[model samples]
Target: MKQVNVFLCLTVTFQMKWLINHGKNSWGIHSMSKNLDIMVKHLTRVEGHGNIVVNMKDGVLEKAQLDIVEAPRYFEAMLKGRSFHEAAIITSRICGICSLGHQMTSLKATEDALGLEISTQTELLRKLLIHGATIQSNILHIYFLVAPDLLGAPSVFPLIPTHKDVILRALRMKRMANDIGDIVSGRAVHPITPVPGGFTQIPSVGELKEIRRQLVEDGIPDMMETVKTLASVAHMIPNFTRETEYISLKHPDEYALYDGDIFSSDTGPAPDSDYLKMTNEFVVTHSTSKHCKHSRSSYMVGALARWNNNYKQLCENALKAADSLGLKPNCNNPYMNTIAQAVEVQHCIENAISIIDTLLDRGLKDEKPNQEPTRYGKGVGSNEVPRGILYHEYEYDRKGNIIAANCIIPTGQNLGNIDDDMKKLVPEIVDRPKEEITLHLEMLVRAYDPCISCSVHFLDVTFVE
Candidate 1:
């Protein structure tokens, strides 16, 4: 067994390739179709640590599981007893990739607890920020992480040589998205301006106009090229499909990524307060993270879910991108998640422009955020984050201090669905070569874009006699 690791300075990316040769009769065994115990100590290309284990004995499947070994982050414990004003700042540390999502959701829950209201300008700015983060995250996942698999390469580093232009295009789009976040929230990665009720500092009309210009000139053109790039490799994606429930926030006027009612394909729309009933999380022994279910054994969330529930609400350009890419509503293939994300990137870019136009027309306001808390109570804030529907629930005391905090991340909710998918996928490909089986499984998980770091929070281990 040999391993090679490559680091690309251009993209700040690292990828690993394994070279294993189990020579015939090396271990007194000659048949490749014998009993097997395949254990992947660590998976690659994802945000954090996880393992995939599949077992089979003489052609009979035994076990297939995604084992998450990351330690619990205990972010909820850190929130307890903290002031309402600091919730967003503290929760932002949960994930660097989705820091803006955490901050916005935290602020919404905190503001609701104190009965605070924000201005129209603030809401418009927040919507732009969400779009920016969505674009940034989706581009990173599709090009840097998943594209290599489709191109039959071990990592994106190899693609850089053959597909240099595609790599550059991806970087350009990512930079523009990050700039949008920086302009609105004061920084891209863990935003600084947005607070409980509003932004501490808002962009000027001039800045808004400039961003709109960029979105119109550069963002849209690049998205068209991106759609073409992905469509060229659409055939590389597996055609497997499994009908399951899709959940996301849905709004009547527009595709909901910022705020809306919880809508499930299995059921209809429900209030955000009923998130607990929607996300019925339970423990699984193979993983440290909890798996969630709603209206079935498992359900999916994220860009694909959003598309399934709110496809009609997408902007004209986004709808066109979907049609061109052959990505449609109720797309049951998990592998199409990457395609959905790409479609969303285009949608978010157009929506950001519309939001900026609205802000410019309304004119910038210098009003400070609402800091006064009329009363303390329980509040739940739900938003369609990059990964999926994220819920932040808080119970505040009279003095505006947190009594309890519960955050249900999108990745945590998708673990069960991934497990179920794996159980079905392994059987279909069990007769093939081991390397092929492993690659397919990896592709399936990457399609979900699982953030192991964000998935592992507090967990209670129980024993049964």
Candidate 2:
């Protein structure tokens, strides 16, 4: 049709213009000074505030850091002396975006410490809740935070005039995901039902069936549309790759988000008990948050890492979406993280639906977790949250009270990797306009979806040469 052709031509023109403008030294930054010192305070469109500082002299890079400027909160210390019953409730305050994840991990750790086993129905509901949170988060990042950069818009608010339909589709998908969490966990944010051992409330069959119907009808179509949109702007993503160790939870049966052993791209697999060693967290002078490394100078986590580790476990629909987006496993490109997230949106939908059907076929039960503490000891719980792998460990006293606690957040694990990424990415784009270079660096950090507020907990910073 003539209208279709006109739209296609206009899109091509826009893409071409954007590429040309961004690829050149339009701002005369390269010529203005032989040395560059750029500081970005309080980055935008992400969950929390952080800074990116880069200093380059005469084309030689120097001093690149992703600074965690947020104030430190002693979350682990807060856990000490708290009752086992309140573990999940208090930990859920870590981040508004990842509240469910914190609650789930905290509960698992507490349950393990108390030597409790959950029911099949409870497990299924937890998985559904995880899927819902993943869907909610990935959709928010892909649509609201990441899309504007690819489409050359200032922000999602500016897109309302021209891209109203796409915005509505995204909002609808996010709402469905939030409702899924609400139905399972009693609230989308800071869920109240999923406590240690098991949930206090469970969804009825009628409610679950309606949720399933909506997922099948509304969720699937919107996801397909989202993939198409990403594919259109895929070219805008920089073709930069820096191979590094990828870490996440892995299982033979399925993509392990809910539970599994620790898996790293460099070092195959380790038991969940070895999480403390696996993290190898250390402090840096440039950051208040701790940085992580394992078998390399830096490593990466989150969706891209999970995809690389468990691509075989992805559902057929999700696999198709990945293939269509040209996203293959063993991908080293961090920019493709947004694409991987889009793929996961499809994967989570399929898995959630299957879980709902299984729950319905088996029937629901109003079971309470009647777990009694037999002994007191240490226990660790790790799961694949949206940002990446999250670990919570607790040492409980004989009286079912916490003595000590430690939580290794995903963004803390990722800080080192982001800094390393900046060191490599800056040189590649240093010849361009300084603003363009800054935008690229910011995009790289945003691709990780770093929750700086969630990460800056407690780290004894030590300055060294």
Candidate 3:
């Protein structure tokens, strides 16, 4: 009992020291002689790079700038002349992490242009594939990427030594989840199996049976254990109970992932067409990414929002697991997102299992293959990516060539909230040393799981002049 107290005390001391390492300066430092502006480009150590600049006035945050300097891939520009089938492939390459979500949206758009509605068998398969993507992305976000900071581990690699079994199970499960997405969507990174009308290739009975077998054999057990373990780790983070308005897709019958109506804490079910109206974005001089404000103001989405909006839609197994940890719908604590991600994984496996079983029950082992559809018209599509709502609007000429395209990425939609979060976060964490500010800012963005790399991506940090 005495040892526990010592450990607790030490943890608190370390947190305090980290938070105030950067001295408080109400005014930023500046040199005279025309205030030389140094062009210091922040080198991003992660896979995607963005930049942030801060002007400090006597140690106070005078200005913070975020930029996605990376040239916007002329993706939208490139889509003008491709076939609908080809455009789907091109769009899928936009984000490595969210390739499947893009695939589903682009395909749905193509189907709209062609006026095709697919079979239930195909729809169920798509649901399984996309849900697998969600599980894969969410688990990656929760365990390896997000948990390290909250638990005070520099990286997942370090945790392996102290918590070998727990970390290994998480890695293995995340790999398996990605594999499930790969099988149905095409590949884990960028799959082409989904087509404008349906899948380029349908699954064989044997293949689906194998997927089903593993769904129960390994998926549920791994996820259930994950929820139990991560919940324990989450209790250690400092000041994690900040409440924010939650937003996500809502379905009447189930927790919406791939298909559902939109819902949020501040509003009831919104028609799909009303999405853009709700997420009104405006530009800010300090950053290149468009800032978003909801109908009322800024709001947040992703796993936490979805879980809160649709907790009642969760299956029995998932609800029991979440409730075991004292989690419920309308959970406002943003820090609870990782737990929500884990809980959603449990629910995803269950949903996939149900979908597979439904397909198998039809008695028609393997369904028909995808062929170009005869229908043609304009269409809009949406699916929930790991981060938030992803929308696609497509137009085609009578000959089946693409004419216009619009895609609203989840990361883009979350920009306003991301900015607002930093507004609150910088002051909370800025008391720490200047060098440590970057790490704290990184944590804030990681919490939102932003995936965009601008031609010159925007990053925010307080800097001295």
Candidate 4:
């Protein structure tokens, strides 16, 4: 075996190609190397419970797979017989990192079933609360979970030694966002402000006035500083890019975070009702996440894809800031996912400010709850999550109980893409020592910035010689 002349794993925004992938929790191997063919009973990288099997027959790479091993939970399948309202709150337990995304998805599904429409003031409040929720989640991902790699630290905990103040600021920012979410969401970790008719409770004028000012004036600026901090570090890597079709929920009026029609570069636009016509899912035996193919091929969704798809809709300041960082439309680099997060933090801040101004000036509009749909109807609810595009499909009863529920989370959507990436990335480093392979894999996960456990968990690798 010939070793590469030089190899360096630099965390600080290493070279990223256009190809961004998601987190995978498992692996499988089928070798035609005439050496060994072992079926992986389970695949994952969590707790280091998996290993890549490489077969070489006279200098030819025959078979390779990095596997994950973790217990799988069927969350969607378990929602049967649950009332729409009950299921809405219960499903929030799916991912600690994906609270607000699931909440709105669940709310929309239930509201559609119930035929309910809320007041304009309520709508504004809903958007504000969700944005606040995203602010918290994004900050957590950018600073607590993601910044360590860009700074070459092992994890957020270790950064305390030298980056204490930065981490503290990030934490406070995250905490403030979560605190706003908690006030509306009931507890922040799993919110319940939304319901079939409207909110379980509404915020007082004093409360709205106070939180709005803080988020726009105080929290937003802090978020910008964090964005600048991350963007300053995004150019270190130049080799992590790969080309893939970017897919997202597109809204013509604004950046599509809360709700919009499903769209892709390949498929122009599909009504929410027609989403099933395009998205297809096949369960992978090796992994819990249902590997998805857009029109039968893997595609991407989430922060980066959303940013790219709706780059034109960005608020002026955010658009200028992203342009300043050299983030163009249709960015294919996975490492730039961090940059997308930075841009969104700014956009969310701007969006929040403008929303407050609109409401404060025009005053809040009032409307009644939607009349319940008597017939069983099906509709899909989709929006950009802090992680990516989240989809919820429901079959409802006349009484507004969820007779059937289906969710295609961002993590599941990225499974096929992640596996494809490993297949391509591993050969580039298979000859390296075991430690080198491990480092590369870790960086791969970090690059995705995935809420993998949003639907599933991380990979567990166990290498077999």
Candidate 5:
């Protein structure tokens, strides 16, 4: 057996040098040779609990999978028999990080079921809220979660001494993003102002102007620095590629974060109502979260998917940022999902400024929510959340109470894709040292930024004789 070479670098700068010199070659052509069994009990730096399990015997690959260890949360069951007004508020509690996304998607579903038509101002405000949520979530993942891996540290805490400026910059950017959420949606975590139809209270012109000014003076500049920082360490990312189907929401006018029709890389556009066909979710014994497949054995839905489908709609500066970050259109590499998210942070900053300008020009309105139901029936709502395309479906009665509800989380849709990537990835790196192979697997899992807790809401029970 050939002993895999390992480099020990202490500082961020030396780590980059090591990555440039040896990292790429480590992942070069190699044949599987060793018999191994690996299990990561609980992966770190992600939202929820999950384990990576792999077993190999006599050079024959046996099993490679991501075990979703988190227990079911029963969010769907909790939604049954709830009123339309309480739907968004209750579902928003599903994820603290993605609460705004859930709230928006839930409102869209509720509004669709109850026939509530929002005004132009309401739509603009919601879009701004989404932009803020995206900015916040992306920044959190890039800096707090994935940066430690690229920088050769166990966690972000160790990088404080060497990368003080970088840490400070991350904090500043996150704070600004949170401020946008606080001002627009009421609070950063679970938004309070937004409802089924419109906001309980509109933001003042002065508040919008201040946010616009800060984004211009600080947010854009910070994003530019973020790109440079990531570019310096981009070589640390693995150079693995596997072409698969990419799925996301696509709109003709914008980047498709707030609203759009369902789009697939393998196939063309489909109405949002056909999400069930696109996401054929099934039971997987290893996971409480149901796995999804569409057009193939598996597909991906998230930042990279949106980039592949909607790169043309990105702002000019965001396109330039993508080029600088090595995130090209039609990218097959899953590791570049982090880079795609960085590009989105840039776009969200610029787009947020534009949205604020539009809102200020139109002036703020203290209009009450339109709760009148023209017709009560079934409705579906879809939005491109920070992780991926999140769908919510509800059936309501004439009295505005929910009879049934279904939610398809993005992480759940990407589980099968993650497992498939592992099967291909493990063999390529099986010859390397145990530690190195383990790190690669962890990085691959983190690349998708899976929200395991969010995905475990669904569970299938069987009663056998």
Candidate 6:
């Protein structure tokens, strides 16, 4: 066994060397040796466990896939027989990073199923909370996960010594964003105040004004610095593009975060009720997380998708930030997702301030939640979370107990697209060093800002005939 292992290692080494020498073709063309294997057992700096597996033999691409190794969380099954009141609370545990997103989406599903109507004030506050969540999550991704690659560091830890100011700015922005969630939603990680119909607690007028002041005095300046920082390292982002469908929630009045219809860049708008049709989820042998495709083999559903589908809805400041960061509309490069996230940080800050001003003008309302259900049946809810568009569907009985549930996280939707990108990217960059190739693959996966644990809800069942 030892001798065989040695022979295998030597063969792989020789093949890599040969590829480095011979493989160099024009971009997007398979001009490499196409004889390599990469098994990143557990990728790092992302929210959950995922592996990048690629194999090419004899100039034919064999397999390129992001294998989700995380066990199935079964959040859907957990919701069965649960009460409408507990749905959001339970589903929010799916991810700590995206807990607020899950909570809000779950609440939307519950309210829709129970025919609960929320007040206008409730809508405004929820939008504020969403903006906070988006800001927090996007800033976290931009600084903690992706910055290390661009700055030539192993992780944010190493940069602490050299890039202390940059790191400090990241922490300050994150703290401010979390403060918004904490004040409005009752906590940042797993919000406690927001319920099916409305918030259990409302921020005072003083609190709203304070948040607005902080946004203007601190958030805006920090965001400007962030854009400059990202722009400095923008050249490090890979220049790769594979045109594919982009999907996100599209709102008519503003950039869709709290709610919108399902919009696809390829086929245009579809009702949120037709999400299953838009997703077209199917199982793949390579991944435990079910893959989704619509209007193509795969479609992306994160910041870049939102930018492509809803760029016109962005405020003027966000548009300027995009221009500064070189994030143009209709961008197909997956790496630009990080850039898009930065742009969103700017948007969320600006939007959050506007929401606060509106709330202040309307005066604080201490209205109780409307829990009286007119009906109970099927409903669906979706939001463009930090990672991408998240979905929750539920059916409730007359007694308000959940009968069935399904959740489609953005990470699951992006898995197939990541795989597709890998197939194209590996061939295009196969001539580079193996380490460089592996780094590119890792960066590509990180570009999606995937939350693997949130996505691994697929369970395969077989029956004995």
Model 1, stretches more than 4 Å misplaced? 1-36, 44-49, 452-465
For candidate 1, give the lDDT of residue 187. 95
The TM-score ranking, best first, is: 6, 5, 2, 1, 3, 4
State each model's CA lDDT, in order. 0.77, 0.78, 0.65, 0.62, 0.79, 0.79
Residue-level lDDT tens digits of model 5 in 17-78: 00112223333324334467776543422333344556665555565655444335566777
What residue pairs clash in candidate 1, if any at all? none
Report the C-alpha displacement of residue 99, candidate 1, in angstroms. 0.5
Candidate 1: minimum summed lDDT over ten consecutive residues — where?
2-11
lDDT of 6 by residue, 269-374 (tens): 9889998999887755433445679999899999999999998888888899999888888998999999999888888899998889888888898999999999
Candidate 4 Cα errors over 4 Å, as ranges: 1-66, 362-374, 428-437, 452-465
Could you give me the TM-score of model 5 versus the true structure?
A: 0.90
Write down the worst ten-residue block by lDDT for model 6: 1-10
1-465 per-residue lDDT for model 1 (tens digits): 101000100001111122113424332133234454555544533443345666665544555655544445567777789998889999887778888998899988988888999899888889999999999999998888788878877667878879999999899899999989888888999999999989899887777788888889999999999998888999999877888899999988889988899999999999999998999866554444556799998999999999999999888888899999899878999989989999999889988988887887777879899999987999888888888998888899998989888888887777678767776676566666676767777778778876523222111111110
Candidate 2 residue-pair clash tally: 0
Which ten-residue region of model 4 has the weakest summed lDDT?
4-13
Cα-based TM-score, every candidate: 0.88, 0.89, 0.82, 0.82, 0.90, 0.90
What's the distance in Å from true for residue 305, model 2? 0.3
Per-residue lDDT for 369 in model 1?
A: 94
Model 5, runs deviating above 4 Å: 1-33, 44-49, 452-465
Tens-place lDDT digits, model 2, residues 1-465 = 000110110010000000112323433345334467677654432333334566655544456654433334566667779999898888888777888988899888888888888898888999999999999999988888888888888778989989999999999999999999899898999998898778788988889998999899999999999989988999899898998799999998999999999999999999889987787876554434556788897788899999999999999999999999999989999888889899999999999999999999998989987467766788888889998998888889988889888887777677668767765577677777777877787678778876533222111222221
True-structure lDDT of candidate 4: 0.62
Per-residue lDDT over 339-415 for candidate 4, one digit per residue giving the tens place of the 0 to 100 score: 77777877887787677676677664443445455455665677677767777777776666666777767765665
Cα lDDT of candidate 3 equals 0.65
